[model samples]
Target chain A: MKGMTIIVKTISSWVKVLIFLFGIYIVLFGHLTPGGGFAGGVILASSYVLLMLAYGREFAEENLSLPVASKLDSVGALLFAAVALCGLCCGAAGFFFNFIQQRWFAGQDRAFDLVSAGTIPLSNIAIGLKVGASLFLIILVLSMFRPDTSTNEKE
Target chain B: MSVPLPVFVAVPLVTAFLLPIFGKKGKSAATFLANIATIALLVLAIASIGQSNVYKIGKWPIPLGINLVYDGLSSLMLLVISVVSAAAMFFSIRYMEQYTAKAKYLSLFLLMVAGMNGVVLSGDIFNLFVFLEIASLSSYALVGFGCQHEELEASFKYMVLGSIASVFILFGVALVYGNTGSLNMAYISQAIQKSGLNAGLGFALGLFITGFGLKAALVPFHAWLPDAHPSAPAPISAMLSGVLIKALGVYTLARVLFNVFGVTIPIGWILVVLGILSMVAGAFLAIGQWDFKRLLAYSSISQLGYITLGIGLGALIIARAGKDITAEQLAWASLAILGGLFHLANHAVYKSLLFLTSGSVEMATGTRQLKHLGGLAEKMPVTRATCTVASASIAGIPPFSGFWSKLILVIAAIQAGFYWVAAIIVFVSLCTLIMYLKVQRYVFLGELPENLQQTKENKGSMLVAMVFLACLCVLMGLLLVPGLRETILTPAVNVLTGGYSYSADVIKAAGGM
Candidate 1:
């Protein structure tokens, strides 16, 4: 299906990229600020959703495609889990998340810096990627069943 | 050796993400990895048996940090979850081959396993709710995996009810945090003791019973089980019926009621009434169903009732006790709880085994309706044999696992002067016997349907899975015998019977308050 009016498409094309960049900022600074993986991820998903609404389905598929989104979703979750597992190698800290903040690697002196908060920022970025990929996939799949105009069957 | 508790949840979560990466082509490798994860959990669970520890996340102290507490009850639940998951995953290796998205299926399976492990190992209320939602969501998707008309309808029904239950639990957790000013269960227990039940705390407990009770499918809240359990693929049916309800519903309910709230007479009576109602109503409803898996689903509610009844009886005795309580009464209460926990373990094995056999039957003949199946004893001999063993076990026949547990329950009821409860218990066993006999007569004995004539026994991993559980059915009697009881059943019972000791146990394991 073709997209909306030329004016809406032109504005969305510009605005969506800005939304995408803001989402990255939220995820990267999750530990320092209130916005974390979940907030950042939703923002990221919305940016792509805005593109799909402004441009047609065909245009969006040509960019990221389905397989790439699916693979990226899995990669994000795996990355998050891998960060958590890295804590297991750092002595008797518990399982799901035990980041290494002390032991000579990442010092506590520079707590406010981007590299601080042990694994929280890394976890946030991974979660942001996962949430963005998953939400986009859900939207894309739902869009496919929306009465394909070229076909005759009543989807 | 004390296996790191986080490994239980981590291995599955990691593998769940990794398996989906295999995508469409590497299905065999995906299944292999999934099986390895479940098996490793089972081995770790075995090693962690009878071992108790508290691991503080990031080494943070209690009341501030989330600590995973491994205790008697946690280990028992861990043992049950791992055993059934390992068996179910093995069975799914071949059984799920017919489904198109095999990799996605395996990933979802691992996700469900991770969620359950988290539920089992979690030491706080909020994290429990999080893990509970993860497991429930994946299960809802898995139930509709076939994408058939019935499966979709059933999945939607299950999801609506399940989401409501989750909301109730979350609300209760919010109220708990608000009232007690803590999220850690041990701290909450201590706070509740220091300040008795206020209005908010009482309301929270009410929400908990309703939420967990709905998840467990106790009578009035059981509208979804009949449709949902039978709609899923067989292995999933086994997982839901065998362990999901227990870990999500019974375990949490028991933990909160006894440990956090500290059982009172009113709560004890409520549990008793719910137990009896579920038993009688479930049995009555089950005896009339012709769908093989549907019949088994109703039977699950009924069997769960017996466990609840035993626990309730024990709780009643405990709550009624004064400072000078009699030794005999204490013994009776302990016996009741022991019966309940024993039945829980036995039922997990036999019930999952029964579902697997039913799956084999369905796979062979392409239907689960009893009227449509007959004389499978001649064609699928192994499935028929395993089905018979499971049937006898569930019906409380002597020498099977169910008989021993029910016997303990009856003896405890009679000893405690609950003659009517004892009578009802015996009467229900007869009802159970009649239901399974119906299953045997219609599905295995009567004239074979012409469509099912070509049906043959399922081979490979399916057979291995069924045979392993069938052996367990015959051997579970040894669990109640004198020596083994000390290690297995006693610790679990002690956790409940110890009652107030839970707070101290947690504090001590965490290296002090």
Candidate 2:
């Protein structure tokens, strides 16, 4: 029974990883397509939920503690804010104001590079990170209150 | 002048994320950091006033790249948002101790603030929707933070309604984009002005009114408010009633309707009708509530109605131009709007203070049902004192912030030839007074309950927070004085008065690049 449970948990974990990767793909392509940070992050968080459901609370907690996830969430928000702050400090007009007019990389003009989109790509990535972490943290914390069924059933 | 507009959103957004890291152990530290962030924002807001600047999100020029626009209106909103959030954050430092996930609560609170700030500053309609969702979603989760049956029920109800509102807004944005081929508000306004009023623009306007109205909890769409406001924790309640609704709903509505759509007569009348309905209905419903917070919540809807009426009336007068209305009439209408905006700011302070007082009372005696609460004045002096000031303000007693705004609104109504509306304002003021007196009589004036004999005042940060806001309630009336009025109120009014010129100003500030 223990071996079978371990195998099942591993398979579930792999599946979650796959789902998370797919969600990242969606988030990355969000600006150009339909899916953005919010939808993609939710998808990513749902993968964690699936793992928790398949393996149990303890399994999920061990891999993704609430504190750790929350910290990541904060960092993501900070990264996003920091990008905007850079715009502010650079005299770029205001927050989230992308001021980079052109790009010169490796002695070549890369004005149209994906990274050259200024605050758009940066904000998108930041939003993706913050949304994913926030959803994960919220889900994890809320799940901690799941009632003990055996005691209630016996009572 | 040099402040980046997006920092207003980014700072809180970053801090909100960083806040949860403190966990249970570093909750106090997190709280302090959050307070500092809000204070920083308050300074920035104050500094940014009277200045108009635009930041292109990715170094790209208008019509292609997203932007954050900062001007008189956005700065005013930023100031209100920061002030309310700071006070609420300060209150939560002590109030949230009873709850287990203190850090998580702070995180969510900051996220909501970040979202509101973004909504106010966003230059792009699609970006506004994104921020609106962020704020709405965070508030939904915070409302359900307690996870009790009532909290969850309210949260679920709020979430359903709120999500629907967001979808409406998103659909509106998509429609506008399809019609104008631009998402930038300035570009859209320019397009609308160039194209004239088309079916698509009119439909978009209707969708915006519905979406923002629901978000604002205007009379027709106010069902979720009474249930949702009183369900959250006291600080969250304060934020929601005090700043969240104004920032996410009223401010956005006014920005879009006035600056973006250029405020036609029909739209203005629609706003006035909505305002009158909310004012009369909300006040009447509030008078019957026994739940202390619920009464306050209902009152919020009513007060917001007055603000809408003032702005809408102003827009109507301006649209009519010269036939029956002069520029003075327009000014008078703005005076009404100024009153509404003033009331909005004042209400934020006093209402949050009231909620904090309610939280203190509930914390001490363990009940919020008015019948179960009585004569704790001697027991909880700080709370009783603050509650009295806040209640007096809400009741529109002379010398309080609420009175000045209500008086301005009434005066403006009468001057604008809307004598009945003026009379209604006075009548509603009386109704508000009666309801608050009932609160005072039931909760503070009567004999102390036997079960609450040992109830004591909340100390530390909670008392500090209550005192801070109470002091403001007494002093806020000074905002009408010449220097202060010129500095604060006039700038805000100018933004609205600038009308369609707003798009021109924004484009100009971008150096017409």
Candidate 3:
């Protein structure tokens, strides 16, 4: 399909950056707030989806290629798993996902702080990355089915 | 020392994530790492046998935090899963090379393994459901990996039924949590014991049976298995047929029914009927199939019937008599459970081997149609030998693993004074024999199709994987010997026969009961 009208494209270009930033904020502060990885990740993915809607498929592909998105998805997941493994022997009882501040941060009493909620924030970041990449990839791939886009262009 | 429960799941999850990074170019490295991860899991499973532990995740208390529990049943399931998965992974090292995106296949395979491990080891009901979804979703994608028309069709069919089952299960879990105010299995059991089966709980139980029975592919709920199993890559077919159904469907059914809901006579009898119907229907249907993998898929339903029947019989007697049963009845129940558990392990090995051999045939000949393929015995001796061993084991020939499990099932049924059940079991055995004989005749003994004259045996990792399972089929009878039985089957039987103790054990492991 043709790109959106110039006015729509121009507005989306400015608004999309705000959406991406808001998603990052939510993921970073997930442990202390209502919004978490999944919520934030979808917000992030929507920015890209918005880009595709306004700028057309080719523009979106130019910005974030399929292979790069796929790689980022895997990297996000691996990062999550790695974070879990790092704390495998650190839980108070030595189980997985034990990100107690005292265990790694050494007896610091930093409650209600950004980095004080143990491994949760790190995990949230990893999940946010994964979910965002996955959603973006899904939307991009699905968008390839349009009448205006040939299958070869998807590759 | 006991291994931590989370590692059972974590290792594979980590491996799954890592493999995809290797991508299109580093396929060999990806396969090598995947193989190592599976072998490591097998070693871990074997090492952790007879050991039990509850790992409190994030260091929180049981009711507050999710925990992973590994006990007799968990260990048994872990053993079966890792064994079949290791073999399948090994086989796929070579078998999957022909398919593009081998890295993604290996990654998905490991994801499925991780999901299965989580399902088996999970102490919380909702955790089980999450893991179940993870495994089911991966298997669906893997089934349609090649993106062929038939593969996509089969995958879609399997996905629709599977999703329906998952929805039913999630609904049941919701009902359970709403009723008991808890999602932990042990707490749910305790609450149920205190309150008894109210209307909501009863509804949940029905939902559980429908959901799990669908996953197990019991007759009337088994429309997807024949199509889905044959469409996947060979090793995946082996994994799906071998342990996925048992771990996801039958194991969960047995666990929830006995340990959580407290097995009742009615539920027990229903399981028996379901088992019998699946057995009879699967056998009759399998006999008429010309597609080699389709026949194996039907036979999976038939063999799963034996496992279900054995468990159901034991459940019937135990549920009827409770803990105060007579010694003879208890003996019969334990024997029945033993037979069921043993057959479960035996089936995981032989059925996977059977599927892998079919895979070898397909890889060599490019088709699974029985009529169009024959005289592979001369060209593919290792595959033929492994296939014969597997067929013999499944057909319940003398001294094979299948014979011993069947013998135990018959003896248990007779001792329980269910003579008709024994007769039906024998009749099913005969039908199984006939079906395999047909497989042998058309697939091995008949004239070779001209198009397949240049077929050669699949070598390397495929051969090794097949031989490993084939040898296991021959040696599995040792599990029935008194000393080995004490080490293996008895522990698993104790887990089931002592169902009332499950909550107590979990509570004790978690802390003061």
Candidate 4:
């Protein structure tokens, strides 16, 4: 996939990949550090924003549509609700109760480890998905209506 | 009994940060996740009710570190926030289609909810200010979600006033800290009790009243509300009008006045005056509105007045314990408060339903002007039915939620020998009825507009949202039934009547000094 991309007129293609990877890193480490779903999501969307700025709107549009983004938003919210509902199913009293605390899963040691803190890790991932998709989709929708600078200059 | 109150704030705080990662590809996943967070919050809120708990943040004890307090009042507010946000989130599934940035909107919405939940649960005064700002700032941005000329203008106005209110609250907090040497509300209350209200405390109280009054959109400070509330999208309008003002403005004012500073006669009278003024002025202003949502906004001010009056009257009755007034009068005062809270919840549900229905109308017919909209009932049966239920409830028609609450308020007023206040309550109810009737006649009962001849009902999640709130409005009266009343209203009322005992209760519950 990296070898196939030869269309960027400015900046190395590796830079874009690096930026995307950094965004993913932020999202994954959200719970452990300052950057979580919202920050990480915005970071992820910026990669696409960079792609649009570098590769143009056509490339972005071919990859994602407005309706598809809306659907992602619905699904993300539903997933968040479902995670909370798990607590209720276990008779733990409320949504998002830390029911997993009693169950011992592999790799669930350490205080700040992803899966160690019960529902926090799962909730964080759900939020990251919602925020990332929402940001990117909004950017796409905005970009679709962006004025053509080339045409404006010609006119 | 030993639950940490901070979890309410911490969960959403964490989730809000985490939601953005899925980016464009995971928008559906994001929405699902946000819903789950709120549902979890809802369960937490319900489970926490009737149980008084305090969690000191960072394991630091109160007076040194911030604490979150959950009592009847906080639990009640939490329940209202959860129910309304859940409905709003469900509605947003389809309603947010016309707008872009669905994820950003949801994140902000959850943030606002988290802020309100925090405000209600926070035992620290300064922390309340922080949460209040979080909620207010998000709301201001949300109001202008459309970025249209009107929405932008309204958002700016709301931001300006809201910022000013925040400043006032912060100033009040600073004064309280300086005067009492404490940021914890219970500690401040204890300090005030030790050394009664000094001039600085007095000034703080005045500032608090003005700040929260502006937030509540009381009569004098309500200019921005009409424009701001109508400008937002439907579910947003619902959330803002339904619970935002009550949670941030009214509930905070009641908590600070009753719990922190301690209520006095002069302060009590001031609240009563503000309440009555808001009621009369809000209803009168609402009667003249041609826009459907704007009318509801004005009515919100009026309804809030009832809550303020109920609480203020309770304070006055307690403060004026003399040879003339007896314990029965005190009980009557409590009854009045119970009525006010009941009305507050009822208004939140029905008002939000009304706004959602208006959104549906606007979505279908492309306009919200009462003059332009006509006979939508024929086309949009679901909206029409829901609107009818909400309108009847708001109008205080028999068997609907509003009527029972209003009745209780009036009866309490009369029993407490506040006959004039009772008359005023009835007068306001009549005006409310007239305004809603005008809405019904112009928007639903009149001849269908030629342009809107092909209007159809809003289907899917929107219909479900409206139906849910409408059903709640009708069934809410059942809350007055003996068994249910003991569970919900009595617990909430006990929290308020408990007054200064709140501190002791919290300390005892936490096994502290």
Candidate 3 stretches with Cα past 4 Å from truth are A91-93, A104-109, A146-155
Ranking by TM-score: 3, 1, 2, 4
How would you encode candidate 3's per-residue C-alpha lDDT over A26-45 as one tens digit per residue? 99999998999889999999
Share of reference contacts kept by candidate 3: 0.76
Candidate rank order under DockQ: 3, 1, 2, 4
lDDT of 4 by residue, B5-54 (tens): 65677567656655655666778887888888888887887777667667
lDDT of each: 0.90, 0.85, 0.92, 0.83
Q: Candidate 2 — which residues are off by over 4 angstroms?
A: A1-67, A83-106, A109-155, B322-325
Model 2 lDDT, residue B229, Cα: 93
- The per-residue C-alpha lDDT of model 3 at residue B144 equals 99
Which portions of model 1 show Cα errors greater than 4 Å?
A: A96-99, A105-108, A147-155
Point out the worst 10-residue segment of candidate 1 chain B by lDDT.
B322-331
Interface RMSD of 3: 1.9
Lowest-sum lDDT 10-residue window in model 2 chain B: B321-330
lDDT tens per residue, model 3, B322-406: 7689988888999999999999999999999999999999999888999898888898899999999999999999888999999
Please say which candidate is ahead in TM-score: 2 or 4: 2
lDDT of 4 at B278: 91
Which portion of correct inter-chain contacts appears in model 4?
A: 0.00
TM-score of 3: 0.97
Model 1 is docked with a DockQ of 0.63
Chain B TM-score, model 1, reads: 0.99
DockQ of each: 0.63, 0.51, 0.64, 0.06
